[model samples]
Target: MSAARVPGYAELLTAADAPVLQVRGDWTLAHYRPLAEQVEGLRTRLGAGIRIDTEGLGALDTAGARLLHSLLGGERLAALAADAGALSGERRALLRAVAAAMETAVAEPAPPAGSAIGDVLEHVGIAMLTFRQHVVALAGFIGITLESGLRMLLQPRRWRPTALAANLERTALDAVPIVALLTFLVGAVVAFLGATVLANFGASIFTVDLVAYSFLREFGVLLTAIIVAGRTASAFTAQIGSMRANEEIDAIRVLGLDPIDLLVLPRVLALLLALPMLTFVAMVSGIVGGMLVCAVKLDISPVMFLSVVQNNVGLSHFLVGIAKAPIFAFLIAVIGCLEGFRVSGSAQSVGEHTTSAVVQSIFIVIVVDAVAALFCMEMEW
Candidate 1:
């Protein structure tokens, strides 16, 4: 029969006809299902001479192929079946050619262990390489930063007051309450701990000295910087990293804007200005917390606690802490902006860089603090 004029299936079959059945049509699972059922009726009558003539079939999906095999009693039945096509093109190729062969359909293959391990190693290698690339980029960025800063300093006219003030306000004024509250609690806890330990030795009076000296010398500034680093550094990385991902950084460059000047500088300046002020607030709140602990635990009057702090802690200690504020600010801003700029294509990259920014900022803060401590110790300041 001509391919286009394959019989409407029912006409080709008769109870009296030999068991050999010539099937035709689209040969889909839907069409073939009814015909397979009809075969059962013929089974009791004549017998099975089932010859599935697929020559006239236009197409066969995977489901149709499986149904065909099932009708044939599987592979042994498949040996009995014959193709209907006669020297047809690939498009009209036999069922085996059209559909993937079913090999006792079973479990899906497990993913290769070596391939998975290779994939993990590849990702790890990419991360390590990206880190190295970023370190080099950061070194270059630092050079650019120093050059820009120096130029801005030399030509004070280049410095925009609005930009500086805006940055300062964001970094300083907005961060005050959180910094204050955190420092206050830290100071209170320290004072309580010191008072408890010292009280055991009948040296509770020294709690004031401990709180005052620690806060002014290190804890107040370090804690405040760390908080800001975690909060604002991550923010900077996320913001700039997202912009980088979206190609806004490229747009800025196209517009002849120095992204560092337009973006990083303001943030850096704001952080530098804000950090010292935040540190001052932290110190004040911490002293107040110490006073609370002293009043409750040490039976020290507020006036006496204040008097002890004033006597034991000097202006130099406060100045030293304040000095570290700018350094911490620079580290936070630089590390945060560097991380943001490091972001490549994916959301995952942004997350990694943001995490790196926080970690690196905190690490640099501690390193700077250690150095400052050594300097202070050497000078006996």
Candidate 2:
């Protein structure tokens, strides 16, 4: 650039203790190197405390700004004072604005503690809403199942025989031996206890009648139902839950198969068919166990024990036990299948619901039996 009239340089300004460096023009690479060297010399003596006076800069370019950046880091430049009044009109506006912003940033206040508490409350509200959604979904599922079951009563052709057979085998045949064995042991233990209590009353011979009537009337059916609930109810829930998790239930629906007919009705029908058969097996085995206890402990012959049981244990007691089997079967199948279908898209949910199905089935069975017993007592049969 040619020599031009420069501003802000006075002889008196150099006489002060502070150094005055003149900027030739709008900074160029050629002018920048000498200015940078001078700034470096000042930096060695003054560190970052050196002031950059942008006054009298004839013109400035990126080269000058870069040299200034090298002389003062952004933070140091923020702290440095600029001779705003002495600077060129544009440069004065830019420097003063940047310093003002830096000052505002440094003085900005932190948010209050109440704002943090509000954020926590917002998160808690969201969590509660999510929980409510899940509860509603579960309630809707139960309602749908019941509605579907009632509708199927008017159209029974949807229930396939083959599916019913499979469900029967799973819920009944597989469970028979276990149910029979448990009830047999229970009957034997009960008979032994009865004989021990009655011997003190001089009525040891009555153990055979006590064991037979109790087993045929109540313990046999109740024990079988409890066992099936633990075994078959849990199995049904797990099987259906697995189908749900693998999206098989959705596939069945897409293929025009009603999940209730294809999955639930079959299980219910099977359990209804299977439970009575299992209960019969349990009753027979339990009587046999009682006979064994009578022969060994009470010194009663097996024939005498059988005769006593036949004489005292009426057909009505056996009928009462058999009658409860169908109701118990229905509860076990329906609750188990319903819980299975209720499984969410998680393995933990499947397990939790499976356990709930077994527990709920057993609880319902006991409640029903209690009601039945109260009715029987009222009728005095």
Candidate 3:
């Protein structure tokens, strides 16, 4: 094998009228480091009448040409090629191409400027438009999903019991411990706060009513739905998005299978089944936790707690909370599945859609719950 070639070097010479820089040797990537340093040093000391002599220039590559062009200003570098008459034809062409590329890159138009308030307004307007588009798309997806679900409902043989059961196990059974634990802790905290505050008014017994009303009318179902939105919605998006990225969804379509029926329906049905049950579990667990706190801190017996809950927190509150669950479940599932379907054929796309599914599900759930609460209040439910 040939011995490794010596890297390029530069020599600076001062003349009567101007300074001259002589470049030599194999100016390729292998010889780049020292050449770059020398070029940078020359750049700082470069004067108005400086000239580059490339008579000894050898084995020039794009990297070396770019380095040389960068060391000299663009117009000045072109002048060097014209005046020096020493650069080889190939090296001169490379320098010109690099100079042109640099010029194009630097020629990008400046961003428009505006007042801070105007900029803020512009961003808000764009956000509102994007949000409108998202709402329309999601509404369309929900309609299509509902139509598909109805068609499957009318066909007994089309029901996917196996898939539904599997999803139920994954979404409901697997989530039970965490859901119960979280609600239990939240319930205990609420009870403690109630007892402490109501004690000042000599109405510690009212703590039972507070715990029961909050859990049954809001906390139980709302907390359950939020958890489901984060866990199950993201899972659905990731699973479906992966299928899309791998072309599994396309294969299903080619096989004359309805992607909505085979993939989305079972998951949606399972969530619809799971969420209400989870909410019920959350209610029971949270109420029990509150009862324990009341018993310990407020001298309220379990019997007394149950009696107060029954008398003061009516069945209507429980019914109202439970009614919200199925609606929330349907929205979460549809948003998840819809975002999944939107994923392009890339891992990054799957990841992006998965995150979007979680955010959209949680946002929609909160908005729907708020609207439902206002409607319920207006109706005196």
Give the TM-score of each candidate: 0.68, 0.64, 0.77
lDDT sort, best first: 3, 1, 2
Per-residue CA lDDT of model 2 for 149-197, tens digit only, reads: 6887777675477887777787778888898889889889988999999
lDDT of 3 by residue, 318-360 (tens): 9999999999999999999999999998989989999999999
Best-fitting candidate, scored by lDDT = 3
Q: After superposition, how far is residue 249 of candidate 1 from its true place, in Å?
A: 3.9
For candidate 1, list the clashing residue pairs, or say none.
Answer: 19-49, 20-49, 167-270
Which parts of model 3 are misplaced by more than 4 Å?
Answer: 1-106
Please say which candidate is ahead in lDDT: 1 or 2.
1
Give the poorly placed runs of model 2, Cα more than 4 Å off: 1-157
Q: What is residue 134's positional error in candidate 2, in angstroms? A: 13
Superposed Cα deviation of residue 378, candidate 1 (Å): 8.0
Worst 10 residues of 3 by lDDT: 1-10
- Error in Å for residue 180 of model 2: 1.5
